[model samples]
Target: MGRSFFRRDPATVARELLGCAMLHCCDGEWLGGWIVETEAYLAEGDPACHAARGRGRSNASMFEPAGTLYVYPIHAKHCVNLVTENAGVGSAVLIRAIEPVWGIDAMMQNRNVSDLRRVTSGPGMICSAMGIDRASDAMDVTRADDWLLTGGHQVADRVTQTPRIGVSRAADLRLRFFVDGNRFVSGLAREHTRPRRDVLGPDKDPSR
Candidate 1:
């Protein structure tokens, strides 16, 4: 076993976590995935981060020491991400995407779909498959009980950085990072844009 995934610096941690593995223990089975994408949320005054508005009960994990799990819900449809960083310091790195590695059967079962593309790829889907929720937030990632971030083979290729997704205020912040050619990455990247046919439907008028 290696050291915990909790890092004191969010930016440094985000970059380092790229090729690490996230493990989940469920019902005597072990489920794991490779971290393919991530985003760093800096402390207060960082317009792109949740803690930028100051600490509160909901985001208390942001202040805790690194290696703490910061899980939370977003848009009422997804359990967005987990933050890893120092406690009570408002620094965290969000796990944005993953590539399933261990216990594929159980991951598929948890996701309730068979399509590999839809399982354990996006942040919310990864959370759903790993049994993470608001209740799991702030949990210790170094613990053996439920979730853990473990050391794995380091990523050798250069990572690509992009603007954070789905936010209006910090949309310009290039905090999101991902492996250059990973297909398991979420559709939020620039290359993952919807097909032009979908954007301009067959019957839709071009001037709208």
Candidate 2:
């Protein structure tokens, strides 16, 4: 991932991150998967954004430089966010789901599951499997060689967009983007969006 890529608008970065692989080095091993799903939280009038009110302790990292990690907890489950836009501007892209493309056995052990889908298909689940937590907050993802997005992924598949899930406010902004038809791309089971539409077409051979 380049600096310019993450420095763009939150919605653009969220959609463009559909196929990039999130690489994380753990215990001397590189573990991660394709970022199949994402959601954008803006700093302006977006009610779902943490900075909608203004910068504070809980959302200070959202105002950090682009590519900073903003990990937070909700209902005992943690979710990771990539800080986007400029410093103090307050915006980030949520890494909603990842298809576990590496370290299957380790992920299974971490998540204590046998099924692939159960291992790392959701935001919190992926955080658990990848050893991501509040400790990762404020870390610069762009500078971390071990925890950065890698290129060369060819996702020749439909990219779908819909309103964000879980937030009661501004839940119909169509800010969530995901790889259409990917089984491991999480959240579809709990949250359903009507009249979903495709935003991007396949560029090359998709992950499938």
Candidate 3:
């Protein structure tokens, strides 16, 4: 069985998540991407976090037990975010970017873009390719029905951490991480502030 996404700490889970597979069933077809990057948003008095104000209808999942999928719309586009940590802790890991692996043809059809690099690197693009929408906000990540986080071969050798993007309050947070040198990773030229780590740890094989 695949490692349960709910059984890990939010910080550890965020770092270990790179290269995992995000699968979604759309129109009787399976579409997914390799998780090349992510961002950690802890509830720790973060003004930019929705949970900063405490739980509500839209952000209830953030307060629920870990492993919930918290999808929401940003700038009129849907983005997929995962809830982490224990209930009422209000921590989450935003799936910032992905590298299209399976169903590239289907993703192209959905995005209508010939440039493969632009199809799934950003939050909005990933959602567009995976068919995520506002209706998918409360999805359960551990389920195989509509969405699931599956284990996969970890191909990312170097993971770089940097500040999150487009956030007014948490602009200085060194929480965003990406697979170094991957074409699908965003902001390749930007200087990172945090230390890079081997994505899968020492015990894991480099080639899975």
Judging by lDDT against the true structure, name the best candidate: 2
Q: Candidate 2's residue-wise lDDT over 50-120, tens digit each? A: 87878778778999989999999988989999988889899999998887777768888889999877887
| Model 3 vs truth, CA RMSD | 4.9
lDDT (10s digit) by residue, model 1, range 1-208: 2225455566667777887777777777767677778888877556867788778888787676566677777765454445555455677878887777777789899999998667877778888787677777776666546665655655655477787767787687778887766767775435543221111002211112
Model 1 error, position 25 (Å): 0.8
Q: How many backbone clashes can be found in candidate 2?
A: 0
What candidate 1 gets wrong by more than 4 Å, as runs, is 1-5, 78-85, 188-208
TM-score of each: 0.82, 0.88, 0.85
lDDT at residue 166 of model 1 (Cα atoms): 71
> Per-residue CA lDDT of candidate 3, range 22-139, in tens?
7787887767777888888877857777788888888887776677778877788887788887767888888877877667789989999999788888989999988888778766
Predictions in order: lDDT: 0.68, 0.79, 0.73
- Compare candidates 1 and 3 on lDDT and give the better one: 3
